[model samples]
Target: MKKLLVIYWTFFKMGAVCFGGGYAMLPILERELVKKRGWTTKENLIDYYAIGQCTPGVIAVNTSTFVGNEIGGIFGGIMGTLGFITPSIIIITLIAALLSNFAHIDMVQRAFGGIRICVCALMFMAVAKLWKSAVKDMLGTVIFIMVAGCSVFLDISPVIYVILAATVGIIADKIKSTSKE
Candidate 1:
């Protein structure tokens, strides 16, 4: 019961402040869940983020579900997702009521612009952290370069990139195993 409440409260705080979605939530999650709460480690959260990306929902929500499930069970998953989305529901509702009146305010526009910049900074920080752990070898570097190039230069789905990377990793592992044998 206490653990479940903690899960809800922690995720509620994260969801409330995690402005730009999954990538933006990484640093907060690392600090709140990993460092403070001891709910998960950096690598585990990254793995959850990866899985969330490839799954069929919003990445932040998916991650919340995964972490919650890990902490408790189905009920935890429910609680986590509820905690994460509750803020959005309330804030969006309030914003929807108030935004029409404030949409033309220069101050509001400037605030939004500042928010966009902050979100970008948060995402960049996340990418840097992820890069340190994800790009550990020659194969990883090659995959990262190829994916980064394609993502920048092409209009392909990221799913394609993930599939290609997974296939490459599998083939490479098989080759190494055969050589060892």
Candidate 2:
């Protein structure tokens, strides 16, 4: 129970301050859970983030549930999810109440415009970080470029890029197998 409460409080604080959506939460999660608390390792956090991305619901919520469960069990998962979402609930409610009036305010509008830019920057940073981590060699670089090209030039879905990458991987493996045999 006490452990669950700690999990709840920690994620609640994270949720309250995390801006620019799910990817933006990663650095904070690393700092809080991995660095400060030593609750998890960097590798564990990265693996959980990857898994969280593939799961249903929001990534942040999924990650909170995963980490919380890993730390405190089912009850911890419940607390973590609730904690992470609590900030969104409160903020959205407040925004919903004030949006109509605030929308007309020039300063608020400007602030939001700046925030949108910042969110884009954050997303770009996440992409760069992931690229550095995932792209290991020339083959990996080629795959990255090909995927980017397909997405940008052909307007291909990311799922198609993933499929193509898997196909390439299989073909490469078969070529190596044939050479060995």
Candidate 3:
């Protein structure tokens, strides 16, 4: 019960201040779950992040659910999800009411422009950190480099990239399996 409360509060704080969407919450989630609370290890968190990315819905909420489920089960998943989303729901509702006025303000627009840049930076930092932890060995490095190139230059869909990577992973494993025999 006490542990569940902690999970709820940690994710609630994350969801509250998280801007720039799901990826932006990675650093905060890591800090809360790994550094502050010691609830999960770095490797486990990275795995959860990767899984969260591939799953439906927002990455932050998915991650919170995974973490919660890991710690406390179904009830934990519910609390964690609620904790992760409550802020966005409330903020968006409030913003919807004030959006017209806010949009008309020149200062607000300028501030939003700056915030967008900072948000991108934060997301990039999270991606870099996660990449460093997730990618291991030459094969993994090659996949990273190729996918990154394709993502940037080829203008291919992300779904295609994920499929390609998975195909390559399967082929590589098959080769490894045959070699050992």
RMSD of each: 5.4, 4.6, 5.4
User: Best lDDT goes to which candidate?
Assistant: 1
Worst 10-residue lDDT window, candidate 3:
20-29
Candidate 3 error regions (>4 Å): 1-60, 63-80
Which candidate wins on TM-score? 1
Candidate 1 vs 2: which has more TM-score: 1
lDDT of 1: 0.90
Overall lDDT per candidate, in order of appearance: 0.90, 0.87, 0.85
**2 against 3, candidate with superior lDDT:** 2
* Model 1 CA deviation exceeding 4 Å by range: 1-73
Which candidate do you rate higher for lDDT, 1 or 2?
A: 1
Q: Can you write out model 1's per-residue Cα lDDT over 1-181, one digit (the tens) per residue?
A: 9988988988899998998785767898899988998887889999999998778879999999999998889989989999999999999999898998898999999999999999999889888987886799998999889889889999999999888888999999999999999
Off by over 4 Å in 2: 101-181
Task: List model 3 lDDT by residue over 26-119, tens digit each.
Answer: 7887888899888888889889998988887878878889999888899898889898888888998898889776787999899989999999
TM-score of each: 0.60, 0.59, 0.59
How many backbone overlaps does candidate 3 show?
A: 0
TM-score of 1: 0.60
